[model samples]
Target: MKNSTCLQPSLATTVALPVIYSFLFPAGLFGNILAAWIFSKQAPTKRTQYVYLSNLVTANLLICSTMPLLATYFARGHQWTYQSVVCRIANNFGTLIMHVSMYVTIVILCSIALSQYATLKKNSDAKHSPAANENFHRCVLNKFRQPEFAKYLCIVIWLTVFCITVAAIIRNNILANAVGEFHTCYSISIEAGKFTSMLAASLATACFFVSFMTVLLSYYCLNRHLSKIQKNTCIGEKHLIYGTVKRNILVIQIILTVCFLPYNIFSPFFYVLLPGNDCKKSNYLVEIKNFLNCLAAAKSSLDPVIYLLLDKTFKRSLYGLFTKSIPEHHKGKADIFTEETPDI
Candidate 1:
């Protein structure tokens, strides 16, 4: 296939991508790296969720840190001035990081939903009898005494993503052969390769859609069950449980739908339109594709911000990092103690 005239990016996009990349990449990379460090320092406990969350943060950081490579590529007029091997490596790694990040998020979200459901179910079972309720609460609390299952799941998730990514890299030679005369790196022969591209993108979209639906359905069922319980019982604590769970689930769902859904929807369209017969007409579509690709990268930053907003432990840790001062009274007491103590 004859190469189509490359579309010139608008000044607005040229400016926006770099600015967004600069702010998002550094901040997100730093934040998620800090989060992973913090999580690592803590002794492993039954809190398997934290393990998964940390892994997700690590993946996001990896993705965000690669944005500068992309920015540099675009800044040079979409030319891949880098070596062919480096270009392929960067592209493949960036893509792998993104897929890993998405799947990690999906796993974490599902875990949260399942945890909430189990908690609610235990509460419901306990409501039937005082003795049974106490025992159930004890059992629920004790469940957190072992982190083995969660750790195993996290390992499995990462391994699965790794295998899938390796398979893709092995099967796709386009990344190796698609460099233009100007050395601009792109996927191969879009018209000829449209089927493979579309197939891969469709599978990704389907996975995302399925995970999204799982989250939505789980929340709906949970809420419905809570509502039924609320109608039957007049316990004040019940309201608190429902309110907290509802708020967290709602925020997560909203972010997933708003920040991530557009990329999923537009990506397949971009791939399909890229190699169509109407080259001039497809220019705008290709531009849109590039824009969406950038948007997907930006989600790495957005995910950490979401964690900060929604996860109380993360918020507290971030706050502690930013706020270094102790209370005035405590400081004074410490100073006095130091002065009075022997020089040991």
Candidate 2:
């Protein structure tokens, strides 16, 4: 018999994983589901970018829905008592959804940033000419009048994500057979090959670093532009436009830094430093690392909450959820505390 040191999860892991899974599974699933629903009700012409966001939320819900099964596996002493095929399927599905969700989020974040920048540029251009303003408004109206492009983009994104996920699963399964594990799932043994392990670590590190830098640079440029507008000598529509852009950019930056960046920095280090051998202390470290990863996954759920608070449309949807009538619908028409518009 080959000697092996399989993980024996600690009491803390046993307790913590289930608790974390409970919170994550329900919150992520319901939050994303609600986001999708609200998005469906919105004017399709409002923001085509939000269609990508809706797909992201759906992917996140799929990923988080699998957490309970993973938690169950861990609870069973990290053993594969389940059928080998079932284990592989579960693991592959969970991993595929997670990776797809993450990459989709990265793409959507970049898209949203670029879209906002473009919108700002368009607005800036409109300031110079009444003719240009009329032309732009006409274009906007025409763009919204058709829904074909948005529908095609949404379909393409879904199909692309699905194809990539399937390809990864097939490739991993083939690789698993050569690595002496027929029943393996998402986790590749780091000890299988030092070169392979190092390569994986390097790739993960590079991706995280690139994403972090991209988001940071995008926001830095946006903030500098907004600051210039704030310091501008003229006051008018540009001021209101710049203010809205600045506020939205600030909120996005804060979420990326505080909620997302910490986990990205932590994950690669955790994967590299933690050995495959299941020493008691090493297992403890792995548990802590997994908890941090859970925190990272939880950020998807948090993103929509941030949107609800920062974006007026989401807030209106939230209010619509809790109240029979949306307060915004009654704006200026009803007797209320005041006829003042709420600040975004």
Candidate 3:
């Protein structure tokens, strides 16, 4: 993504990114660590969900780990010599890992949506629902509901993403363009390759869209199916299940919209605009791309909070850490969306 002989430090590179990354690093790190600890304490019945969530936490931690190096390079990479090892690790490897982690999270989010939908659909009363719909749901999403299957699925996702990212890195660095001296660290964005960079960006954007649409569809079906049950039931707080599921779905929806959507929306355009552009346009594109990337990284920071709010075990564990008192009324609350009607 080199545009000229040397890039001058802009406010985006020097101030905005460093400040943003500094905030993201510690916040994301602490949040994900807490999430990991809570997940480890989950009961064996939650093994399926633990598989999905554990992988998600791992990805978030990976994203946070890269932030410091990225921030440091942006803050003062220019002062360092061009041959410094920090430059390669910060711009090249850091960016690659971040991309891989982002994609892993995206895929896992989609899996969560499908998994929850299947669980709900299977548990829904069969008399009111079409038999074919239940059969279809079981046929498609039931396998993913198993803990062993989910573990394998996550492993495959990681390996696939890792391979794709490594291939792109090799192609971009070794095949697309010769290694050029970068006088300013700010200009050392993870792009120097031409076609391969575009391919990587396009693939990520495509993956995001597919996952986003899948999540939206899952939410729509769950809402449509569960709303009926909520309406007909004059019994206990069955609505609690509906509410919890609805809120969790809403949280993920918001997270996806806020953190992942915008970056993916505009990233493909950067590669297209990179070629044959003047220095001014190139710099602007780089700034905009990097800024959007920062927003995407914020997903890691936000996911921990999402888990804390929507995941009951995480919330309880966090609460217990601060205080030992447990309320009598809260002693036997039912699992979210699992028990449609508590044995009242």
Candidate 4:
């Protein structure tokens, strides 16, 4: 019932996103690019965690690459037509890509948590071995634990997310076409697409919660095991190993909580919960939503800090980048990944 003028952008709304995102764009680009380069320098071993971590870097890179477009959209999206080709491209590349990165990062972090737990579980078991009844163990997410299989699964994840995102983009463009072009790209007429948008948001919210729980559960079990060891004696090698592993899991959980939680919690409100007819309420809510989304998109830059904290090889590789003094530089590639290096 309200006119489009009701939710007109405030100067804060206009300036905030572009400023925040412009800064995020360069920082994210440099961080992710640095991460990818460091990963590439690692010895060629199909370690399962490496696979997930590399894909995470790739996902983060995808998000950061779109920051400029997203920044521009926040500043000027209302002036564009959703049905235009350029608008559609921006919607997909800038907005849709952010969601894709979000979900991809979530799923992969879940994979990492579960995979690490499985590794820790098997290692703690005295009877567990390479040939110890893999048939029974295969049922326990073992398929994802294998490096070769992990590559295939990561590919499937990318494809599945792309398919879903593209479908949403197509549906929006079609609806925008039908609704007539004057609606402005930013105001996608809540009354027209409320059902579909809310349904999608509900599904995505459910998925996010599932990933959140998975990370929490993994952290609990891992920390519990480590707690037992540390209580006995914190000086041992086992205590140190499990401690680092638990810290890594904790960092992942923190990233999910800080970066994505607010967005997921508030996003579903834009359709069904919020009264779009109320101008003041709608305007403030829209700004909040955009700011929350900016936070979600910020994980791309934060992941490199996690890598530094959790990955010894990556840390050493980063050190390698600056220093020419490689330890045993003459040692062949085969000797690089020695038995002395515990693959934790």
Mind giving the per-residue lDDT tens digits that candidate 2 earns over 135-245?
765454334222355446557655665665566556655665666553322132412223433444355446556656765666676666556545653545446555565
lDDT by residue (1-344, candidate 4, tens digit) is 53434557777656888888899988888988998887777735567877887899999999988888877877877677655665566666776787777788888988887776666655554333345575576457566668888788789878877777667656765765676543555653522244445665677788789999989988887677556545654435654555556666677789889989898888877655465477677777777877888888888888787677656666677777888656665343222111122432
On TM-score, the candidate that comes out on top is 3
lDDT of 3 by residue, 1-344 (tens): 44334456687788889999999899999888887886676534456777888899999999999999888877887666544688668767897899999999999988877776666666665445556656765778787677888899999999988888888777755642465644444452444455666787788789899989988988898888776766776525656665676666666777788888988888877776766637777767777877888889888998877776566666667877788755566556654423222331
Compute each candidate's TM-score over C-alphas.
0.77, 0.74, 0.89, 0.86
- Residue 72, model 4: Cα distance from true site in angstroms: 0.5
Residue-pair clashes per candidate, as listed?
A: 0, 0, 1, 0
Model 4: lDDT of residue 211: 92
By TM-score, is 1 or 2 better?
Answer: 1
lDDT of 1 by residue, 1-344 (tens): 34523444565446766677778778778777777765666314346556556666776877786777666544544454324665655556656666666666666655555555555455565545436556765465335322565567668877876676556654554553464332345323322233444665676677778767867876897688677766777757446555666666676677667766787888776775566566555656755665666776666777767666655555555665678533443331211101111111
Q: Which scores better on TM-score, 2 or 4?
A: 4
Model 1 clash tally? 0
Worst 10 residues of 1 by lDDT: 335-344
Report per-prediction Cα RMSD to one decimal. Answer: 8.7, 6.4, 2.9, 4.2
* Ranked by TM-score, top first: 3, 4, 1, 2
Please list the residue runs of candidate 2 whose C-alpha ends up more than 4 Å from where it truly belongs after superposition: 1-4, 81-86, 128-169, 182-205, 230-232, 236-240, 274-285, 328-344
Task: Write down the lDDT that model 4 would get.
Answer: 0.70
